[model samples]
Target chain A: MSALLDVQSLRVRFRSLGMLRALVTRTPDPFIDAVCDVSFHMRRGETLGLVGESGSGKSTIARTVMGLTPAHAGSVRFAGDELIGLSSRDYKAYRRDMTMMFQDPVGSLSPRLTVRSLITEPLRIHGIKDRNRRAEAKRLLEMVGLGEDFAQRFPHQLSGGQARRVGVARALALGPKVIIADEPTAGLDVSVQGEVLNLLARLQEELGIAMLVITHNLNVVRHITDRMAIMYLGRFVEQGPTEEIFHRPRHPYTEALLSANPQPDPDAQLARIEIKGEVPSLMNRPQGCEFHTRCPYAREHCRQVAPGVSHAGEGHVYTCHYPLNT
Target chain B: MTQASATQPIEAPAGAVLLEVRGLSLDFGSSRGRVRALRDVSVSVPRGRIVGVVGESGCGKSTLAFAIIRLLAENAMITAGEVRLEGRDLLTLTPRQMRDIRGRRVSMIFQDPMTSLNRVLSVGQHMIDIQYRDKISQADKRRRAAEALTRVGIADAESRLRDFPHQFSGGMRQRICIAMALLVEPALLLADEPTTALDATMEVQIVGLLKALQGELGCSILFVSHHLGTVAELCDDVVVMYAGEVVERGSVRDIFKRPGHPYTQALLECDPGRIHEKTRHLPTIPGSLPDLVEVPQGCIFKDRCPHAFERCQRERPPHYPVAEGHTASCHLLDETRGNHS
Candidate 1:
């Protein structure tokens, strides 16, 4: 089947504010390449995981696809229609088919709105009204594992888990085919995280919606996604089947990332394959390969020249000079 | 996290007991009401070992840590308990005395380094504050400050010392905090969710640095965090707290392998990292943490526990011994007690 959403060479850059800032500053224009030439696609009813650190631009990619963040270059084709430069009038219609679940549940939700109104807000925007919207709200609440009793409660009245449930319900209000869950389980209690993840997984299966799960959590991606992409320094370093890439990562960065994730089992012996130092700021990113500074196997060529994409067996492909052993 | 093993006799598990908290109970008297944050919470941090305190938010994990250093909010008061550091009760210490012990003996690294470290102050000034009690020369303070920064792996320590807190990245700022905390070489360090704000990659780096530094420095760390994976990785001993109570306490291996308490078991299962066999529904505790303001009379975890019975709702369950030095608070263990009290 044809791809549901196709993103090609998507580049999102944020300049150091505009207008008033430009008038105040004399230094050369500073910009961070939030998403640098990232490309991927998702089939109908498929789940793709985007794994990266805070400044790795996974969030930028999500926002770019949603047309919320204007792109510097490239195309976001949703069902063969270009999302870039879509007029404000057309963007509203485009939004009906795709929705994003934000990271902060407490901040993302309106304090004044009850669960019913929060869920129904999307429907109301699209002109659906009255009793049907209320019925749909109750259905959405139940869909996310909340009972009808939750519909009347305000955001403050609900717990963190309940607020997240309402967030998911609101995202599904428009019956979107594509769901972008941006760190959906972040800031949640471990037990509550499991519940929300389980609910999202269950709903994805039942509704058959294509989802782009963006998170720093490797475990979440491992459990939920069909395919995965590992982003580093705003670039997609690796992309393949979740199992293949995880079991035998072809990229040096991916290997380090996988090993870096602390396993819950106390008996598990950890290998010291961690990358040293924090993620580099986008402003002062490495010259050639973004990961060369941290990559254990980096050579002289790796620092001066960016590695090209090397295809492995099956759908596995990674941009690494010396790939990890299978 | 910072507690003495109050009711239990000090088995003294091969390491010198650095900090011992006994019968620690804390209450926050708000306009809403008095909320009992900690209930007879006891923990012992052995010398040179990292003890992990794992629990959900508002589970009194931070409250217990802050209370040990006597840095709780104005509304909060330590109603009962004693925190003994080196056999001396800290609860009885005055504010001035407590301030002296706070940085010199027991230093705390909060979750956010940005807020904890003064925004306007240079990284070097923070070190001088800690060394204020000592009549060290300005040069010595600067030299020692740079030395501490270098120890934590910050590049160009001399130049970085001039940089403000904002100039440093999240990971770098955290390193500065750790450096400043360990500047005077405190006997014990109380880290309250130090890496929660950091990214995963950054977290591992910080954890590694902490482990390496702890090994070299030979100082005990009372690391409190909600991330079970991180806790398991860094800690030798694990204390699982729920609703202001120590539901389970044991060696990391014992807790992971044979979690006796239903809450601990549920928590272990709930971690996404614990997924061995792929399944649609991840096992959850099924309920939120019980309200702290008005704690129930019986077991605090009874409402969410699958194994809880009528007896669990009626009477509070005391900690029952399991393996050597391992104990779990549960009514189910009462059967193993052979009907004894």
Candidate 2:
């Protein structure tokens, strides 16, 4: 199948300091690249996970794909239509086929609006006035496993899980073919996190909609994603089938990240590879391999020269001078 | 590392009791009414062992930690309990005596490092301020502060001490918090969700540091967190709390391997790490926690338990012994009653 949503050579940059401040400080470069040459594609009904630490540009990539953040240079095509440099009016039509669910469930919803109005706001935004909004709200709520009584409730009255369900309802109100959920199970208890993950899984299976999951939670990524990518300082360190990467990761960063996650089973043998130091600042990124500063297997060559793309197996690729388990 | 170990104050014998709470029940007088925050909660931290109190939000895990350090809110009333440390009842101590014990004998690490740290103060200043009660020289105190920072894996400890809290990253700030908390060489450390605010890599670093520090310092830790995987990895003993009550208590192996209580079993099954298959639906506990404003008559988890019977609905279940040093407050384990439905 052809790619449903494809992003290639995507580069996103942001102003780290004002021009005046940069000139006063004698800084040569004011713009910092949040995302650098990241590429990925999703077929119809596929789920792709973007995994990274904080400030690794997972959300920036999502926003850039949504056209909310302007890209420095890239190609974003959805269903054979190029989305880059499109006008707001022209983008409105794509908005119906691609919707985003924000990270904070409660804060994303307007406090003053009732659940009925909140869910149907997308329909109103697209100038769809023919359908009954109250009925539509009920349908959306039912789709998210919420009862009809929740239509009259405000955002504050709902729990974190309930608010997340409402957010899912709102995202589905437009019947988007692609849903970009940023941390769908964040700020929820273990049980509630399961409920939300299950709901998303069932929804994807039922509607056959492609999903782009952006989260740092590896367990969530492992459970929901078919393909996964690891990001370091906004660059794709590794990308492959989820199970293949989990069992046999080629990149040292991917292996360390998987090992760092605490397994619930106490008997699970842990061969943890502890990475040292903190994530490097985007402003002062390392000269060569961005993760070499923390990588355990980093050598002198890795510090002096950037590594090119290396393939591990079918559909598995990593950028490392000496990939692990080769 | 050698210098820090030489200054260890007390070497309590292994397997000796350090802090014990017996039948602790607390109530908070709120505008909505008196809310029963904790009920008959009991836990013991043995010398040099980490006892984790695992629970969800509103489970009174944090409140139990505060009650231990005598830092409860103004309106919190401890109706029934005896908090004993080193075989002496701490509940009978005066405020002045309690103040002395707080930092010198028992220290705490809160969830958010930003709120706990003073923004305007330098890291060295905060470290020096915490040692006001010590009678050591200024140079000795500074040396100890730098040693503590170094022990927690912070590079350039001497120079970074001059930097402010904002100068450090989230992981470094939390490392500082851990360092400061352990500087006093307290007998018992209360870490309330210390790594919840950190990233995965950072969380691993912090957990490793904590394990190493606890091993060297020989201080008992009452680690409270909602993350089951973390508790399973770091804690030696486990106390599972639900709706302000300890529903199960056992060694980490016993609790994780053979959970007797239905609530605990359900909680373990709900963890994404435990669910190995890629299924359309994940298992979940169906209902919410019961209200605690009024004293509950039946079992706390009766509403949500899958194995709840008539006996559970009519009366509260006592902590029934499941195995050696393992107990669960569930009627299903009551073989004497023979009334499990």
Candidate 3:
């Protein structure tokens, strides 16, 4: 089957300074590339994860995909239709098919609006008036395992987990084919985090909706995603099957991340690979390989030249001068 | 209400107890009513050992840390119990006395590194200012500050000290926080969710730094965090709290391998890292925490526990010995009622 969403060599840039300020400062390059040459596609009902630290441009990709942010280069095709440079009205038609769950659940919800209005607001915005709004709210709430009584309560009245459920209910209201969830289980208790993960998993399975899960938590990516991409300095250092990446990561960054992830088992021997130095500023990116400054196996060659994509196995690719597990 | 002797038989694990909280019950005057924020909570930090207090939000873990440091809010009332440090009751200490002991003897590492440090002051100034009580030359204080910064792995510590908190990254700021906290060489360090705000890589670095520093400094650390994996990895002993009560306390291996409390078991089971197989539904503990305003009469976790019996509702269970250094507060651990399941 054809991929539901196809993105090729996507790049996003944001102006660091105003035109006048840039002229005054004599800045040669006034723009910073938030995302650079990132490419990936998602098949129908396939979950893809974007794993990265803060300022890694994972969220920017989500924004660009939703047409919320403008992409500087490359193509983003949704169901065979070119999405870039589309009119706002034209983008509105695709909005029903693609939905985004923002990072903050409680903050994303309007404080004044009740849960009932919050969930049904999408339908009202989309002009889907055939169904009873109240009944529709109840149905959506039930789908997310929230009861009918929650409809009357405001966002503040709900717990972190409940607020997340309400957010899910709202996202599912329009019955989007692709859901971009950014840090869906963040700021939740362990038990509650599980509930949110499970609810998302069940809904994805039952509804056959593709997911783009962006989170720093490796465990979340490992548990839910089919295919995963590791982002560093706004580029995919490694992209492949989730299990393959977890079991045998080819990229040094991917290996460091996996090793650094704290396993719950106390007896598990932890030889954590500590990535030295802070994440370099996006405006002042490195000369050659962005991660060479901190990469344990970085050589003089790695410092002088950028590495191209190297295939490890079928569907597993890593960009590294000396990929591990060769 | 008789005093609960929860800390009676904590087998003195290898080292001497540095700080011990006994039957520490605290209440806050909330809008609704008097909220029982903490209920007979007791845990001890052995010298040179990392004791991790794990719990969800509203479970009073942070409050425990604050209470140990005597930094509770004005409305908070310590109705019962004592926070003893080195066999002395810290609760009875005067405000001036507490102030003297706070930074010099029991320093704290707050969750948010960005907000904790003064944004206006340079890292060097903050470090130098913290040592105001020391009767030393300005140059000597600055030299010592540089050494502390260097110990925490900050490169070019002397030069970097001139940069403000905003100049450093989140990981570097946290390292500075750790450095500042350890500068005093306090007997006890209360690190409340030190790595929660950090990224995965930074979190691992901070944990590793803490482990190494604890070994070198020989200072006890009370690490309070909701992250189970981090606790399992960094802490020597684990204390599980639920709705303001310590449900279980054990060595890291005992708690992870053989959790007696249903809450701990459920919590461990629900950890995404523990689940190797991808499933449609992840294990979860059903029901929300009990209301703190009108605190439950019996076991706080009874409403949510799957193995809760009639006895759990009638009376609160005491800490039952599971092993040499492990204890769990649950009715199922009651040998008198054999095989409650």
Best by DockQ: 3
- Complex DockQ per candidate: 0.74, 0.72, 0.80
Tens digit per residue, CA lDDT, model 3, A134-187: 999999999999889999999999999999999999999999999999999889
| Segments of candidate 1 deviating more than 4 angstroms | A17-29, B1-10, B335-341
Q: How many backbone clashes does candidate 1 have?
A: 4
Question: Model 1 over residues B202-296: C-alpha lDDT tens digits?
Answer: 89888888999899999999999999889888898988999898888889898988999998999898898888665657788886777788888
> What is the Cα-based TM-score of model 3?
0.97
lDDT of 3 at B291: 90
Q: Would you give the TM-score of chain B in model 3?
A: 0.98
Considering every candidate listed, which one attains the maximal lDDT? 3
Query: What are the clash counts of all predictions, listed in order?
Result: 4, 0, 0
For model 3, state the Cα shift of residue A264 in Å: 0.9
lDDT on C-alpha atoms for all candidate structures: 0.87, 0.90, 0.92
Angstrom error at residue B178, model 2: 0.2
- Alpha carbon deviation, residue A131, candidate 3 (Å): 3.1
